[model samples]
Target chain A: MRLIELQRRMAADVMRPLSSRAPGVSTYLTPNTLLTAADRLDIYHRQYWLRLLDALAEDFPALRALLGERAFSNLSKAYLASCPSKSFTLRDLGSKLPSWLKADLGRAGKYGALALELARLEWAHVEAFDAAWIPPLDSAALASGPDLRPTLQPCLRLLELSHPADEIRLAANQGTLRREKLSVGTHPAGKYFIAVHRLDGDVFYRRLEAGEFQLLRRLERGLSLGESLAGRIRGLNDPETAPSKLRTWFEAWTVLGWLGE
Target chain B: MPANKFNGFTDLGIGVGLRIPHYDHIFSQAPAVDWFEIISENFMVDGGRPLAVLDRILEQYRVVQHGVSMYFGSAGRLNREHLRRLKSLVRRTKTPWLTDHLCWGSVDGKYTHDLLPIPYTFEAAKITARKIREARDFLEVPIAVENVSSYAEFKMSQMTEWEFLGEVVERADCGVLLDVNNIYVSSRNHGFDPMAYLSAVDPARVAQFHIAGHSQFEKYTLDTHDHPVIDPVWALYAEAVARCGRTATLLEWDDRIPPFEEVHAEARKAEKYLPEAAAECA
Candidate 1:
């Protein structure tokens, strides 16, 4: 066989799901005293699944926690079947998992919303962990320019989630949340606003008010200061309290260095 | 030619992988280390903590970039974007010479992330050698191909693994990172003499040596790198150093990593096998 044909055949055999029948390897591979061609090929096949599964588990710990081990494994197998990694880095292995979960609700079962939210948060966490860092507007600069645009930091991720994903993720990471005791239906769900950002080489999460979330989203879309405040942001319950809340949010954001081009 | 003259690169002495678990110890303790070998892909990021930590590590010690995803044996066009990111990192680390596996792990655009063995055919060698030459020219750095421990071999392979390796390196005008443990593992699996494999390797082309442990299973040995180097592998290292002279050596412990001191101690064991003068100098 040609080199290309051999490689494609080997890759197909190694990438085939474990539950399926093994690929016919005797034609291409040589058997030894201790192992058959099938047995030898199985080594690579098993490593492929084990390595990818372990990587996904590391990246999406919260989603794994929410779905339980068995369900998470089944879901990951399905996801890998559909979206075999395209990038050279294993870091990009989970890049499309959030969208995959959102698109395949039947596979997600009753915990679709909760699972999707957790996956989104985890994926955002991965992005925020290594996204490029742009220098933030310092307090002195902010004080000097009253018309400064509130551009979001490149590393900042604004999430408007229906489920309290941050809380569940923290709980799961700390071992306080158990899949057996939790039910998606009974969990408290509401509009949860969050900012995932990097500070001093560490990733962090900060809850935000609905107005702050909307304003940050607008800023991330490259909105100018005038456009951002000209009724573009909604969900502020009290119009009278808008100016004072905006002042407080800007002060905290400036201190955290969340505003950048 | 001496080992350093293989590609005009220095023997960087003993080193360990720059893994994350030892970050705190590496930063705070600042222990004496000859060098650190970083997985190039781990730091080939846009910006943030990975780069920050890498910059800090660069400040303290000499770092050599080792990669796992070059996939030069694949019969498709090389990924330009991957090479671009790798070159950016090469500028960052300023690694004397970069090393990647001599195996194919991707087809078309999909990646397996595992080093799959290549068929030892003239066609495959010619294609792999061309890709290596292209990468070496583009990156402007010396490149070395590391032999991978593989379970399966192609029935249509035209030659032995070492003969195929010699053919590719000679054709590409590159260096070889002769991994002794891989030799031991593949030799055992494929029923070849480890010494014969080493004898076939050109001493003048050997740029580095990798000593790692493998898991012994009922059927075959797996290059897991989770345990300490066994006696026979160390003996192989002795013979390899004897043939190749003093070369840069690294210990790989990717899974179930122990304390930094323990890993360092394991890497330090290679000093005994090195030439007496070089051992003293290191």
Candidate 2:
């Protein structure tokens, strides 16, 4: 057989379910003294899938938690079939997961949206944690004025989420989450605008108010300081987003180094 | 220490793989590590903690780049994007040489994301060697192709593993990062004599040595890189050192990693087989 054909066959064989007859082993794989050809080939087969599976599990713990162990494992198996890792880094393993989950809910139909949102957030955390460093606006520039246009640090991720998946993610990280209790319909539900950013070489998160989230969103898009604040101020007609809140949010944002300082 | 034949690559003394578990210990204590070998793909990201941590480590120690995804034997055009990122890192670390396994890891555009074995036929060697030469010319640095542990053998493999390896390195005009433990692991898996395999390799092409552990199952041993160097593997390293004289060596403990000191001490064990380490002790 041709090299490419052989490789294609081998790739399929390794990813095949264990119960399957281990395809494409003959002609190429030799049955050595100690192990049969199929058994010998199974070692690489097991390692190939297991290692990638472990990386996927590590990358999206909350989604895994929400889906339960067995369901999540199955979901990943499907995900890899659709989107086998193309990047050299295993970090990109889950790059297509959110979309994959969105298109095909699999067994978690009712919780699909929540799972999708959680998957998005977790992937954002992965991207933000090691994203290329962009020096925040210097303290001097930040101190210059509230007049400064907003720019986000490269490591910052601003996400608008429904279902408060961050809370569940926290639970997952803390190991306090019960996989049995999690679902889209019955699980904790709420709208949350959150920031996931790295500080002092560690990843952390905090909840943001509607107005605060919007202001940061605008600023992140390279909006002027006045423009973002004015956009938020326009919402002052509502009690929750009154003009009085902008100043306090700005103070907090600047202090947290969210204002590109 | 004997200077490497290619580009005078230094024999970076016994070193441990730079792992995440030991990062705190590595960064804080600044342990007396001779050098570090990183899975080049892990640090090839665009500006994150991995790069930051690598940058900091590069400051205090000698670091070499070992890649898992080069897939030199894979059919079709090399991934230019992958090569670009690798070159950027090469510039950053100024690694004396870059190494990846001599195997085909991807087919078409899809990657299996694991080190997949290649046939040892002369046809396979001709194609693989050409790709190796292309990679060497493009990277403008010494490139060493490692022999990966394998579970299956190609029926059409017209030559032995060492013969195929020698052909690839010789035709590509590249160096060889002879991984000793892999030799032991593959020998058991394929029923080959490890000594004959070692002797078959051209000593001048041997640039570095990798010492790692393997997990033995009922039938075959898996190259887990999760345990200490077994006595047989150590003995193989001794033979490799005897053949190549002084060579750069690294200990890989990627799974269930122990403390920094423990991993370093494991790397230090290769010293007993070294004539220089013996000379110094005397």
**Evaluated with lDDT, which candidate comes out highest?**
1
- By DockQ, the best candidate is 1
Q: How far out, in Å, is residue B225 in model 2?
A: 1.2
Per-residue alpha-carbon lDDT of model 2 for B46-146, expressed as tens digits? 77688889989989998989999889888766889999998888989888888999998787777878887788877778888888888778887788889
- CAPRI band for model 1: high
TM-score for chain A as predicted in candidate 2:
0.85
Model 2 over residues A184-233: C-alpha lDDT tens digits?
34456777888988776677788888777887788877877766666334
| DockQ for every prediction shown | 0.82, 0.65
What's the lDDT for residue B90 in model 2?
A: 90
B1-282 per-residue lDDT for model 1 (tens digits)? 234644455867899999999999999999899999999999999888899999999998898899999999998878999999999999999998899999999996889899999999999999999999999999999999999998988889999999999999999999999999999999889899999999999988888889999998998989999999999999999888888778889999999999999999999999987876355445
Backbone clashes per model, in order?
A: 0, 3
User: Clashes in model 1: which pairs?
Assistant: none
